[model samples]
Target: MSAVESSARRLPLVLRNPSFGRVWAGQLLTQAASRMFQVGAVWWLVGFAGGSHRGLDSGLFLMVSTLPAVGLAPVVARVVARHAHRTVLAGAAAAAGAVAAAAALLARAEALPMAAIYAVGLALAACQALFDPCLTTSVPELVEDADIESATGFELSTQSVAGLGGGLLGPLAVDAGGLPGVVAACAVAYLLAALLVRSARFPHATARTGGGSPSDTAPASRTLRQVLAGLPFIRRVLVCFAAANVFTTAVYVVMPLYTRGVLHSTGSTVASLEAALGVGTLVGSFTGARVPGRPVAVGSVCLIVMAAALGLPGLAAGHAVALGALCVVGWCVGVIGVRFVALFQRLVPADDKPQFFAVMQALLGATFPVASLVFGALGDHLSARTLCLVQGVGLVPVALALRWAGGRTDAEELPGSATQSPARAREAS
Candidate 1:
């Protein structure tokens, strides 16, 4: 093959589109900065609490940050429906940068109270709640239909890459110049993301809501009705994803206990397990688009594999086995997550995409914090191994249920199917 052919084969088709490439680059920076901000803020909060009620403070901070996804999603959906994709993306990024900069300035002056930090976190989280769904909905508009899956795969990979980047960079920044350095770094990232997105083109011709469309002027009630009408097709998959998150969250609660109680290990072992999981997720993200099948079916299989991986650590007698199991869990999650995102992109109408993704963010976001709390409470009464086994067993039924519920033909899942009226489609768009 010629060098050009080899290069074409090696590169992701979506990235060849300059507009998408810029937007993707912005996503990378924004996500990494978000991670860094999370790390720096949490670490600072813990230390500032002086080890008294440290866990409670940290937990509350995380919950506060997450609440926006659930509470503000409806409002965000409306905002998204009324604005251009590029406008929303750029504005959110700018808002995040401004918030980070304010936090950094306050921290430098030693005037950063816990309450103030919480407020900053809430602001940043709200920005993210707006930014993420808009970005997800923009993918199809940015790339050709044929490249959507590959684009989704690349987008999903951003989290793993950001996780690894933040894990490494967060500590270095903290060590070099403490919380101020990290927050400053985050501000720079957010601003850069804003600039990149501001310059990128989002074609208005294919847009569903903005550009003075009738749907842009539609009442919130009608929008809600449209979203509700489409729920039955996707609810099963959403439930399955949420249920799987229970097991995933349990890892955070159970891993430390499992390490100390079962493996008789230390913090280094925990770090190793985390690193393994991150590496596996990175690998899985790159490969997810290549796996051939209907996305929903493939995601179901991935959920099953993930459930088994979660349970494996409980049955393992050595650290290596547990490590391998977590790696598998991460890989399955990465694959299934990409598939689900791509599936939603295909299934949802363009106008309803924002609301759909917001609902998704809320569903997935709620699972982690709530499940972690429940698992933490349970850990007080149960062995880590037993809890792991129970979580694994619990997800089997959810996974199977998703497979059963996903039996509808692809035609039925689209917007203008027999079950939907032409008038309703027109109103929705």
Candidate 2:
């Protein structure tokens, strides 16, 4: 009972750390604000336009929001790497708050043009490029190495909560608050995120060190090397992802077809599995965060199990069985995600962490969609179950390869490091 109680309290205890809590709260507010803004903006555009141009407006809005983040990623990476993580994040959030306030004012005055809306959306995406890496890189600074993995799990789970909430609450917010009210809410949220982050006390940021201070603002540059600092790390990560993503992409493409063709079910039935998957992921994240062990081994095992779970729906089983499989898959993914991110943080140098994250993001953005399209095309003639089976069975070797490489990487990283954490050493052995 005492052991169980301690495990239960780990999350709450971690959350109570003033420094980590501040950053965590800021992340929660910012992500919720982001989801609220994205959904509300899209809905507003479709409602107000109410014509053939609506489709074009919607498409352009997505492209504008997505492309700017990827395009401006290198710049954000440089700023996060060289200058100061805290400053970059807080400044970007504050700037976003200003943009949100301006949009709210314009909406209230009935003078907000579609073009202006696109511009604001693009600006907000750019802010995200700054926020994500700054937060990831600064995690090690906020807590001891022992707590980093758990800290990461809690951080990511916040996004999942916001994603689920944003979908449910976005419509309600717009209905109750109006366009102006929604935007105003975003502005307040962004401002609060900024304030929370700005007040957090980070030791590295204020340390008396040879580098002057971690918070010492250096001018960010757009140099070739700085732009490409994380290329090697990106390559390594993508190699692993490439093997795993085929299975994931297959699941997404196959889910719909399996529901209709195999289960003779409706879209609502499919949604139930997806929802279960998400809830399972949230539950898994908490567990993943608390577990202290070899990340690579843990992540690889989860991936293997998740890959196997993807094929369960293909079985001529009932809907409940399929949903159970998906839940397991989601839980596995949640665990894998936490470990993968922790490994990446441990692998990359602090100054290069943001660049590595940016490259990883860009590669993921481009890769997964194309893989889905390819898989969707395959599903035209192939049975979804067959596809799932093949990929699930095939990806196990890839997971093993990742486990091997992870061990090697840990061994290589520790020898050069000034401080070696036990997790790294254990994995290396």
Candidate 3:
């Protein structure tokens, strides 16, 4: 096990690609900032609203942070695809930094209204609409095709590490620096993410484009239409992408209920569950380098494993059992998410990556509020264990459907996709 684990820690190979290293480092900072932001934001909102309708306030705030960004994704994706990833990403980060700074100032003054805070959250989310896709799509740009998976793994690992740190340190940050300090810290993080990635090149930005000519008056509508043109392909091959996001979001919605009501555990125990999952995910991100299969297929298989693992929490008789099951779930999340995203990077046209990711993100965001409300409301009447069971069982067919669709579409699109060729295919139908 030790020898196998040592082999999995191939951090040097990825870092050797300086461009990728900078992007990876920047990604880590931004991801950590996101966690910090969430912690600080949730705490502040909870404090401000007090007891009554606290659930509504918290859920609405969380949903607001994500939903508004969806409408802006198509535009964000278009910009990212048309311009250099570095430019769009840096700009977005700078914008977010500015917003965070303003929010920090408001927080320091204790003048931040819920509306203002929600607006700032919306602004940050909008910036992410641009920054997120560029960051992911830029990975393939920075690394060689053979190392794409590693690069993708490195990216997901950033989230795991951030999650661990954010959930752990967020409260401490709030107590030490207060909400203002946390927001300020996030500002600094965004700025750092921008500065780091600014020097990185985006080779894929040079792909075929309708713009960039000196004489041509590039029409915005035309560019948008071209960007939206990839929807058909995305729909056919990525049926489960949105479903996966919904399930993952549902887990977040359900996790707390399970901890408090079902396990009769304290808040710290909820934190522990998140920490366990983060650790498990971190391990998976590195070791999954040897997962040994096509990313789409491997990802599909991992989803099934994750779904199975999710079902375990429902049956778990105690905290330890549930904790172990969550770790398994996290491992699957780490492996499968990277695989699916790497496949997205590989299969989509270099120019259309921004569009593809944006649309998907938008769709996922659209569901965040709906899923949160549905789960939150249902949790009132149904047992958390029952909810977990339903969510777990529900995902199995989605995984299978994704796998079957991928196989058929990939085989049709790529010549030798009989093995894992489906992922390599540029377009299906």
Best by lDDT: 1
Give the CA lDDT, 0 to 100, for residue 93 in model 1: 96
Query: If the candidates were sorted by their lDDT against the true structure, best first, what order would they fall in?
Result: 1, 3, 2
> Per-residue CA lDDT of candidate 1, range 1-429, in tens?
999867875776645677888888888888888766665555454333344444445555666666787888769878887788898999999999999998889889895777887798788888988888788878887876767898897887677887767645654576567778888998999999999999888763265443675647865533534775655757666777787787676565566557655787544565566567788887777688888776767877887888888888777767998889888887887787677777677567777776667567767888867765676566556777887798789888888887776774344456656776654332211
The runs of at least 3 residues in candidate 3 whose Cα sits more than 4 Å from the true structure, single-residue gaps closed, are 1-24, 43-55, 78-91, 111-113, 134-160, 171-181, 191-237, 259-268, 286-304, 338-366, 379-386, 396-429
> Each prediction's TM-score against the native?
0.68, 0.59, 0.68
Q: How do the residues 74-185 of candidate 3 rate in per-residue lDDT, one tens digit apiece?
A: 5765687678778887888888888998888877878677788778877887776677667876776677677778788677557667779776565456656767877898
Q: Clashes in model 2: which pairs?
A: none
In model 1, state the lDDT of residue 289.
Answer: 84
Please give the ranking of all candidate structures by TM-score, highest first, separated by commas: 1, 3, 2
**Each prediction's Cα lDDT score?**
0.73, 0.68, 0.69
Better of 1 and 2 by TM-score: 1
Instruction: Give me the runs in candidate 2 sitting further than 4 Å from their true place.
Output: 1-16, 46-48, 53-56, 144-147, 212-277, 283-358, 367-429
Residue pairs clashing, model 3: 410-422, 417-421
List, residue by residue over 147-210, the lDDT tens digit for candidate 2. 7888897786787887555534443455566678778988998999999999987765544224
